[model samples]
Each structure stands twice: as C-alpha cells, then as structure tokens.
Target: MLLQVRELKVGYASGADVLRGVDLSVGASSVTGLIGANGAGKSTLLKTICGFLRRRGGAIAFDAADIGKLQPSQLAAHGIAYLMEGHSVFPGLTVEENLILGTWAFRKERARAKQAVERAFELSSVLRAKRKVKAGLLSGGQQRILEMERLTLNDPRLVILDEPSLGLSPKLVHEVFERIAQMKADGAGVLVVDQSARHVCAASDHLYVLRLGEICIEGPAASFSDRIDELVRNFI
Candidate 1:
C-alpha cells in the first residue's frame, strides 16, 4: 500500500469525536473510494490524513514511513496532493498564473514548468481560452477543472480528492472521473470521497462505506455496488 491509515480517531475542538477507529488504505495502482452521508467524518478523515487535523489516536503511514505528525507541506513533499472541497484557486490571478503556481515545485526548471502548463491545458480547452482571464471569472465547473489541472503539476504519487464532482454538470462530472482514470494510468494512488456511492463504485477498485466515521462495509468496489443504495438509506 502507498498510504495506510489504521484505527484512526479524531475529535472536534469541543472534544466531540468525529471519526472513530477508521481503517483505510490506498495503493499506487488503484482508485480507493470512500462514500458516506453528510457530516459522516469523510472530510475529517481526509483532513487528518493530509495533516490538517491532528489525530487523537492510531497511525498514518505513507510508503511504509510513519507520518502521523507531519505538517501539510511536509506531507506534500512526500508526493501527496490534497484537493479539498470548493474552489481554492487565487481568485485574482489569471488561470495561467494559477497553473504556474502549481508548478512551483519545479518552476525553476523552465522546460519542466512549460510541460506541466501544457498538460494542464490539455485537460480543458476552456482553460486555455481563459488563460488570460481572472480565475474567479470562470464558472463552478471550470474553476474545479483549474484546480484539477494544478494538482497534476508535480505528478503527485497519491491524490486525495474530496467532493470532486460537486456542483458539476453531467458532462463535467464525467470528465472528473476520466481524470481519475488518467491518474491511475500515470501510476498514482487516488483516495476519493464522493457523496454518490454508485458513481464512486463505478470508478474505484476498492470501496469503503463510511457511516458516522466508521466503515460499515468495505470490499472490492464491484461487490458493494448492488447494495450501495440500500446501505446509503440505512446510513441516513
């Protein structure tokens, strides 16, 4: 496994537990999907793994190295890229400028930076057309694509996405999953959290159904799709 999370526990500032004994893993060659209801600690788990939240107990290991206490920047150095919910681009910057920021890890390498930018453009013609426009001017889906393009800059080893297809049109949502396939082809592990269990199951190799921060069911994605709808209702 490229990322291993064991018996994870987390609490809010008020000491109320949000996650309880969660176990999850992601591998280089697979797409791991985590599906659950609203406020089920799905975001919390991803946040903790990315070092945004401190774990109250258990371990988080990446590539066999214990990294439970690393800061977000340090975790990024280990080839982990986190795309949290919402549009996180610099609203004032032009789309091209934002993409250049993504290549900061290799910006000094002129040729490499150019290649990264071009690859980002390849993901969307709209991005290329709006390259000179302020990022804030783009629609919701376009902004989301911009963020996705930025993540591909340094070719992260593991990509963690939270609500990746949120507020997207059917076409744009399909593009989001297509990007996931591209990531797998490029050999990066993807840990994805989606509200739609069926959509996630279709794109994942391994599926984990989280309910109130606990994994209620876990197995190969295919095996769980048939019961996903019922499981979701039960969770509600």
Candidate 2:
C-alpha cells in the first residue's frame, strides 16, 4: 500500500469527534475518491493524514512506515503532498516564484529545483502563461491548478487533494480530473476528496463514502457510482 490508515480518530479540543475510527488504504498507481456532504469530516481526514491535524488515536502508515508521529514538514519530506482546499499559494509572489518556493525542501540542489519548475510549467499550461503574474491575480480555478502543480513537483509517492473541484467551472473541472487521471497513470497514488460524485467516481479506481465522521461504504468505483443515489440517501 502506498498509504494506510487504521482506526484513525481526530477532533478539536471542545468539539464533538470529527473522525471516528476511519480506515483507508491507497494502492500504488491507483486513484481513490473520498465523497461526503459538507462537514462530513472528509477534510479532517485529509488534514490528519498530512499531519496538519493531530491523530488522537490509531495510526497512519505511508510506504510501510509509521507516520502518525511525523510533523507536517516531515510528511512532506517523505513524499506525501497535500493540495489543501481554497487558496494555498503565496499571494505576494509571481506564479514562477510560488512554484520555486514549492521546492524549498530541495533548496540546496539548485539544478533539481530548476528542473522541477520546468516540469511543473510543462504539465500546467496556465502556469506557463502566467509565470510572471502574481499568483493572487489568477482566477480561482487557475490558482487551484497551480497548487496541484506545486504539490506534484517533488513527485510525491502519495498525493492528497481536498475538494479539488470546489470552485471550478465544468470545463475546468474536467481539466482537473484529467490531470488527476494522468497522475495515477504516472504511478502516483492519489486520495481525493470531492463533493461531485459523478466526476470523482468517473475518474477514480476505488471509492470511499464518508458520513457522520465515518466511512459508510467502500468499493470499486464503477459499482460505487451505480449505487451512489441510494447510498447518499441512506448515509448522507
């Protein structure tokens, strides 16, 4: 498994539990979709996996090593990249500068860093066009794509995306999904959380439905879509 979570739990100090014994796994070269309604703890699970949120119990293992105790930066160094929801890029920097910062972990290796930026620009044509423009001036969809490009720069073994389609138009959403498909084809394990069931299910190899802070169902993506309406009515 590229990533694994066993009985994971997380919650705020005074709030009710947000994740209750959540368990999941992502296989190499596979795209997994996580679906849930708003406030269903989908984002919480991603945060825990990326080490941004504390794990109150259970374990998260990446590449067969225990990562539950690793810090967020440590997890990033281990090739675990997370494209967080909303605007994650630096508002003050140009697109190229923002991308260069993405390679901060490899700052000592100037040649590799330059190569990664070149690859990112190649993969995302929008970034190429807006390379000299400040990231804050880009459209929401464009910014999201840039975030994904930044996350993929290091060729992370596992990528976690939170609500990647949230603010995109239909056309842009299709482009994003295509990019995600390409990632899986390149042998990167991907775990994506999104509310668009049709698009997400269509692109994923496997599916996990989360409701009330727990996984309600999981199966092959095709089968999951066939039963999505019924599942949502019962679980969501």
lDDT of 2 by residue, 7-112 (tens): 9989988567899899999998999999988888999999888878998888999988898878888866788888887779998899999999889888788999
lDDT of 1 by residue, 92-203 (tens): 9999999998888767889998988987888689898999999999999999999988987899999999999989999989999999999999999999998767789899
Worst 10 residues of 2 by lDDT: 227-236
Top candidate on TM-score is 1
Whole-model Cα lDDT of every candidate shown, in order: 0.90, 0.88
Candidate 1 residue runs with Cα over 4 Å from true position: none
| Per-candidate alpha-carbon RMSD to the true structure | 1.3, 1.4
TM-scores vs. true structure, each candidate: 0.96, 0.95
Model 2 CA deviation exceeding 4 Å by range: none
